[model samples]
Target: MEERDKQLLKMIRKQSEEGMSLLIDEYGGAIKAICSNVLRNYDAGIVQDAMQETVIRLWQKLSQRFQVKKNLRAYIYQTARNCALDYLRKYQRHSETDFEGVEDMMQDVSTDVEREFSRKHNERIVHEVIKEMEEPDRTIFILRFFYYETVKVIAETVHLKEDNVESRIRRGKKKLKAELLRRGVLNE
Candidate 1:
């Protein structure tokens, strides 16, 4: 455990408001990102609710029971993921396709260094490709894939026709895939 983490632990165990504030400030974005990745396209309220539940769980349960003080990030992430998924199952808001992808996402990462490195390299290349895309195309791609928004919602939000949105999504994906393949990120 780093000295900073130890201090954070001390502050939280003592129930200091500042400690809680600091904890929220430190890990809040990461927790929200984790929730967003899992819960995707659910309203922002769902994400916020999941985040709040994670904080509460950390404060109420983990703090008392946890002995090791190395990192709270992973614990917070797991709690947020569970909270978001529970909310989803209880609500039944996702499509079959979305649900299918998430099961694979929840699987643990490979320990193989080469595979992990290649995966990350491909991810970077994909992000770079997205960054270089034109305006509505970039927005459309991010809305559809990253936020997990549906074609209808993306069309309405982007003020494009549904057909146009779908076309752009298809085109954007093709472009990204071609770029990745050319860069040797994908099997041809």
Candidate 2:
């Protein structure tokens, strides 16, 4: 935490809306970038919702629990990742297409473009796998790996009970690794 961040957090701790606004102005882009990356599809409405959720969570808890010694960027990233993941888990369930055609589509993209295409294709597969996960597991994985959120904060953001976040993280990693292997991203 920089001296400036410490000062800003102090102001925010006072529940000054202006301080919260300043925090958003300074950190919103980074948070949005992480959300967009994790969601793999961007909508202004979804982004705004995630941003609002993150800021509200921070405003509610920053004074009571935040430590000036912690990195604010990491905190913000964790919050944004959780917010986006929860939103996706809730809303994407009814919207996702089955995986039946995705592999076939990837196979036709041509050898010259295959490597570049494979990278994106893998991302799509990962996104699809995430969509299949249950509430807290899905949320936990997106924060842990996609946004590189720390375990402790991930726990706080998702409102899990005890080590539920960590346990979900473990299971989510195994599932993702299996999915990648099944997709041939990891060679047998």
Candidate 3:
């Protein structure tokens, strides 16, 4: 942690309103981005609710006696992810397609229940594979597929050239498809 983050931690440990405000001022964008990325399948209201829930969870956790002192950013990111996933679980909203580019990964099922089950299972597998991916690839995949960000926006966010972003996304999809195939989850 930097000196600035240390100061923020100190303030947040006090559980004061100003401390919470400082925390938000420092990490609000990241929190919102995490929530938006995780809850992209849902509406703005759901994302906003998850963001608020993340903030509340942060406040509760940071004020604890055994709160995280180091790697505060990771904790915040994990909290945002958890809160968004909780909303997903609460509402049982699933993505309509198997991400943006992998629509053919799922085979056509005869029954709606089987289709839903297959989609949820395949989605879980894809998420697991993406989580195991390396840095720039993982971040690029999440931004591109989960957040539905354009290649140019992804390039700016990840500080890469547009071509580089496109290639990374392509490679990420290839790797994902391979993983799904290896796991016998793909239609092919």
Q: Write the per-residue lDDT of candidate 2 for residues 77-138, one digit (tens) a residue.
A: 77888888888886687456656677777776587486778888888888998999989888
For 1-188, candidate 3 gives per-residue lDDT tens digits of 66777787778788778888988887787778888877777899999999999999888877785557566766877888999999988777345432754545444434756878988898898889999999988988886765556787678667899999989888888888888999999768
Residue 149, model 1, lDDT:
62
Q: State residue 52's C-alpha deviation in candidate 2, in Å.
A: 1.0
Name the lDDT value of residue 148 in candidate 1.
58
Residue pairs with backbone overlap in model 1: none
Order the candidate numbers by lDDT, best to worst: 3, 2, 1
Q: What are the runs in model 2 whose C-alpha is more than 4 Å off?
A: 96-188
TM-score of model number 3: 0.55
Candidate maximizing TM-score? 3
Clashes of each: 0, 0, 0
Looking at candidate 2, the ten consecutive residues that score lowest on lDDT are: 93-102
- Could you give the candidate ranking by TM-score, starting with the highest? 3, 2, 1
If scored against the real structure, what TM-score would every candidate get?
0.49, 0.51, 0.55
